[model samples]
Target: MAVRTQVKFYYDVLSPYAWFGFEALCRYQKPWDLDLQLRPINLGKIKKESGNISPGPCADVFKGSLFFPDVQRTSEMMELPYKPLKDFEESVFIKGSLPTQKTLAACQILYPDNMEELTRQSWLGLYSHDMDMTDKGNILQFAEAAQIPDVDKLLEFSVGNEAKQQLISNTTEALESKCFGAPWFMVTNPKTGRREKFFGQDRVEMLGWVLGKEYVGHHPSQ
Candidate 1:
């Protein structure tokens, strides 16, 4: 059997750039035969280890400022929606509980239907709706909007022992991957145990290039 190439994404809910990368991953799915491994870890922890400040405040501003013209250009090039982040500042605030719960909750929804949408919705809750994804009420509200019922139940799972353990496992795996940043992807060769790392959505096409696949370019405006 040909060995399947694994693509691991290390992301945090607080990053608009990470959200952008998630969409890129969704686009790359079929062409690369990617086996995506989602690794969700606290970007705060990663920043602490790397001795860096949180990119949330500055990055949100930059994204919001550059978002419009970029959106216009990209929307013209591609069919995806291009809602600028000009008024999306309030949504950048990351409260621990809500974003954590919503991230896992979206995972619960998409792990069954489509992991891509799950990742996309988690970001949408934060970036698009301008909602605080860390609050239970907000998360529940977004869940309902996403057509995921039983917000109470999913929140329960988000805090359950199993979920906690898995989160820890995912964190450990990310550290082991020798990465400490948002929008990171790593592929481990099952046979050689060799790992390849790509940081930022801009490098995603490089991921395809590394795996011996053709690169479908992202929108030029990005």
Candidate 2:
């Protein structure tokens, strides 16, 4: 019997990069025979602890200006939707830990088969439609949109000690694993017992390579 490979995806909804990365993984998981795992992380806490600022707000004005354009280019390359939330820096920053907690709660309640859809809906709601995920009402709204059968149960679960601790533990584990950003991947091939870490959606090809899949380099026209 062949041992299946496992790919653990660490993400935060606050990042557009994470949204792209999540979609990329979903596209490749079936083809690669990967046991995909989604783990919620708090990128804000990770950045604060690591003394790193997001590129969009970095002191280098030129670098800061390039961040959104780079995101647009990557989104186009991946053939995924990209949209900037109005007042993102000001409004979304006030959302605190709610988004992460909500994701953690959803993961606990939803089956693994449905996780990807839930992730997509949440990401689109926040990044594309500018839904305020930090708001409890918006959380339930998005949950229902994602086809979660019990939105109220999900909301109730999100506020429990178990859900909070799970998010905290996942975030702590991510930091311990040297994850400094969202969309980080920890790939483990059980057959060969190989483990590697990958960052960014652009590295999906490299991840495929690690899984023994042929690397098809990006073609802009594709």
Candidate 3:
């Protein structure tokens, strides 16, 4: 039997770019014969540890103007649903994503089998449906959408110290791995036994090249 290639995707749900990358990876996982691992990390922690500054959706006047148009075109090309968060300031800045990030980590810890689906639903709840992910009700809804075995238990666990610590651990792992952004891709070269890191959304074709798979832009199976 052939060994499936391994790919680890590190993402924060705060970025729409991560949403696009997540969807693309999900669509391509089967055809690429990948052992895709989904990892959720805190983006704010990553930036502080890496001493890197990330430009937000409307970080400033100049780049902010281009952010949405690019988002629209990319989402259309990738065929994933895209919507500006209904409350961008609250979601991205004030309320923060700690609780949501912990819930995602909890899902991975308890339901590794449904990690991808759970991440997808979690992102959809925030990005596509405009649901406030910091709310426990919405987090449980994401678990339900993913068909997790016990969502009430999952929600309860998400707030505990265990889940909070798990997120910190995941963030530290990303930093130690030299990650500075969401949607970071770490692919293991099967033949060489080396791990290659690719950061951000536009590296899908580059990943294809590294993995020896055909590149046709974003995953077309979406």
Write model 1 residue lDDT over 51-71, tens digit each, in one string.
655544355676556655664
Clashing residue pairs for model 3: none
lDDT of 3 by residue, 165-209 (tens): 888888888898999888898988887888899888888777888
TM-score of 3: 0.94
TM-scores of the candidates are 0.75, 0.89, 0.94
- Please give the lDDT score at residue 184 for candidate 2: 92
* Candidate 3 C-alpha error for residue 7, in Å: 1.1
Once model 1 is optimally superposed onto the true structure by TM-score, how far is the C-alpha of residue 161 displaced, in angstroms?
2.9
Q: What is the lDDT of candidate 2?
A: 0.74
Q: How many clashing residue pairs appear in each of the predictions shown?
A: 5, 0, 0
Q: What's model 1's lDDT at 213?
A: 73
Model 3: worst 10 consecutive residues (lDDT sum): 213-222
Question: Highest TM-score among the candidates is held by which one?
Answer: 3
Per-residue lDDT tens digits for candidate 2, residues 44-135, read 88888877667664446887788878888887877676687677666456665465455555565554555677778878777777877777
Higher-scoring candidate on lDDT, 1 or 3: 3
